[model samples]
Target: MRYFLKRFGFMALTVFAVCALTFFLMNAIPGGTAELILKHTFVGLEESATEEQLNQISSRYNLDDPLYIQFFRWVKAAVTGEGIGTSYVFRKPVLYLLALRLPATIQLAGASMAIAVLAGVSLGIYSALRENRISDHILRVATLFGVSMPCFWVALLLILVFSLKLKLVPVAGYGSLENLFLPAAALSLHSMAAVMRVTRTSMLETLGQEYIRFAKAKGLPLRKIISRHALKNAMLPVVTVIGFQMGNLLGGTIVIEKIFAWPGIGSLLVDSISARDLPVVQGCVLAIVSMFLLVNFLVDMLYTHLDPRIRYG
Candidate 1:
């Protein structure tokens, strides 16, 4: 309970700080959402609209208000479940636009993380068990390659080979399970590499401990000793890495999303940024930050259960 409380308190403070910073940063950027809207809406009416007409549009969106007042209004609307106002670019409710696009992003992130955890852990354990063997050497080389490759380049290569030359998957735009494999594979590669390294390191250290030797001395089966004892201890650091990677997966999806035409939050952010859609940008940032913080908190709680020595300070 004490650990949970402390973590929750710290996360709350961090969320508040991030929210403030996001708000101020958005405000600091020159030109209001209203101006952006007018630029798009009144493309040929620059000379036709009177100064008063332009001021009216700005006032209608409350863009003329002080920055702090605008922020408070946005917060109030957000808290009261009034939605994320309207986007200057799309001319639709920001929340509605996000709702339309968020699932694709969530699917991408979830699939990537799942692949990373499973593949990474398996490779890590395999490498550890066969330490210094050819298999271990090959796995290490593969992991290093995965870690070294840039996500954009990987994405492009996958597109060029699988989608273009081989025709194994669709080239771009997401739909159905078939669309997920390539982007998920691209997103998970680096995370999988990191997990493999961590798992190998942890397992090696755990294998050296006296308890593992004791289990072996008892004539326990290799599988039982490794599964029940060695792997369990090695999982602590793996869990930490997995949790952090979940957050990274969300943020890192932007480039992959764009490349694949996946309609995830990262892509939405890019689109919103290009159009200067403040509400959409703000809402997406807040949502991503909240998710990142929530995952971290859950991982911290899991640490205590996974390892007895991990006590809350």
Candidate 2:
């Protein structure tokens, strides 16, 4: 209970810090917020926004308030569910825009995470069991390739191969499961490689332990020894890598989402930034931070389950 309370308090502080930094840094951007909002909001119009219009926007959003005042106001609003404010570009509530996009982002993150864990762990086990054989060498090379390549480059490569040459999936855009493949693959490759390396290393070490040798000498079935003994112990480090990667995938999907034209928070954030949509930008940052923090917290709690020795105070 004490550990939980401490972590929960720390999480709250982190969220507040992230929001405060985002708010102040956003304000520090060059030019007037209202002017930028007006410029983008009425783009392609022959006439620019007049002084009166800019003033009205400023007043309506409390843009003229002192910096700290605006920050506190936003915090209050956020707690009340409308805290992120309205989008200057879309002219809608920021929360509403996020709500529309969150499901897609969650789906992408979840799919990518699933693929990384399943493929990485399976291949990792196979490679470890094989040791110095050709299959293990090949998997090692593949992991190197996965880890070395940039996600955007991987995304383009996947598109070129799967979407263009083979027509296995669409070039971009989202809807069907097929649409998810390229982006998820691109986003997950590095994480998969990382998990593979960690799992392989951990599994190798666990397999060499005295208990493993004893179990084998006692005529324990290979599958039972590996699954019930080796795998469980090896999984501690693997779980740590997985937890970190999951949080990273959630935030890193921004690039993948934009590349694939997925209507997720990543693409929304990119558009919002390009348009200088302050409210949307702030809201997106908040959402991403909250998610990342929440994932880390859950992973910490999960430690107790994975290892009996891991006890919280």
Candidate 3:
């Protein structure tokens, strides 16, 4: 309980800091969300972008308030679930915009992580069982390639092969399983590489342990020994890799979403930043931070289950 509480406290503090930093950084820019929205993003409103109108819009949200005051006000509003304010660019409730796009982001990130774990973990086990063989070396080289290549390039390459050449999936846009395949696979490749390497190394070490050698000397079937001893014990570090990579997958979607034209929070965030849509940016960031923290917390909880020796205070 103490450990859980302590971590929870830190996560809370980090969230508040993220909120404060995002809020201040957005306001520190020369123009306000209202001004930018009126002048740039919502250019259609430019005709009516009078000084009085701008001030009224700003005051309506109390944007003119001192930074501290505004920050506290936002915190209150967020805690109570009243509202997170509205987006200047979309002219919709910030939470509403998040709601609209969150599912797509979840779908993309979830799919990516799934691919990472399924392929990476399996391949990791396979490679470890065949360590020092030509196939193992080949997989290690491919893993390095996957880890080294940038996501955008991978995304484009997948698009070129699947979308452009084979026409097997979408070139861009989101919705349906078909639209998800390329982006999710592209996003997964890096994480998959990372998880695979960690799993292979961990499994290799675990297999070299005295108990593993003892089991081998006994009449225990190789498959049973692997399933019961090797894979289970080797999962600790792989779990950590999956947890951190889940967060990365969420954040990485910003670039991938734009490339694929997927209407997720990441793409929304990028567009909001471009338009100086402060409220939307803050709200989007807060959501992302919350998700990242949540995944870490869950992974910590999972440690107790994966390893009987792990105990929390």
Candidate 4:
């Protein structure tokens, strides 16, 4: 309980700091903040939105107020769930726009993580059992390739082979399960390699332990020994990596979404930034930060279940 409370408090503080930083940084762009916002909001208007319109926007959002006051006001509005202000570009409620795009992002991230864990853990166990053999070396090389390549390149390569050459899946766009395959594979490759390496190293170490040797001496089945002893112990570090990678998946989705035209929060954030839609950008950053913090907290809670020796005091 104590640890949970402490973590919760820290998460709140982190969210506040992140939101404040994003807000201020956007306001500090080279051009005058008000002028840039006005230009983007009224690109269709003659003379970059008249002074009368600029005054209306500023007064309405209290943009002319000191930075601290503006920050607090926006924070209050956000917390109360009343509204997070309208988007300068979309002319829709920031929260509403986020709500629409969030599910797509969640779906993509969840699929990618699932692929990473299932494939990575299985391969890791296989490689560990083989150790220095030909198969193990091959997998190690493949993992190096996975980790060394950038995600955008991975994404394009997947598209080239799976989509363009084989016609196995659509080139891009999202709706059905087919649309998910390429992006998820692209997004997951790096994490999968990471998990595989960690799992293999941990498994090898665990297999060399006294308990494992004793279990072998007792004529225990190799399968039983591995399943009951080695795999469980090896999983601790793997779980930690998975938790950290889940947060990273969110950041990765930005590029993946844009490349695939997936219409997730990443694309929304990109568009908002380009248009100087401060409210939408702030809301997206807040949502991403909050989600990342919550995932880490949940992962911490999961430690007690994965290892009996862990205690959160």
Of the candidates numbered 2 and 3, which has the greater lDDT value?
3
Error of 1 at 113 (Å): 0.3
Query: What is candidate 1's lDDT per residue for 83-145, written digit by digit as tens?
Result: 867887778988888788888888898899889999999999999999999999999999999
- Give every collision pair in model 2: 77-83, 78-83
Tell me the number of clashing residue pairs for each predicted model. Answer: 1, 2, 0, 0
Alpha-carbon error at 188 in model 4, in Å? 0.5
Best by TM-score: 2
- Residue range 1-313, candidate 2, lDDT tens digits: 9988998899889988988898788788888888877778775643667889889989988889999998888789888876579888888999899999999999999888899999999899999999999999999999999889988899999999998999988999889999988899999999999999999999999999999999999999999999988998898888889888976797678899999999999999999887778779888888888888887777777778878999999
**TM-score pick, better of 2 and 3:** 2
Residue ranges of candidate 2 with Cα displaced over 4 Å: 45-47
Candidate 2 lDDT? 0.88
RMSD of each: 2.1, 1.5, 1.8, 1.7
Per-residue lDDT for 19 in model 3?
88
Model 2 superposed RMSD (Cα) = 1.5
Name the weakest run of 10 consecutive residues (lDDT summed) in model 3: 34-43
Question: Against the unseen true structure, what C-alpha lDDT does each candidate score?
Answer: 0.86, 0.88, 0.89, 0.89
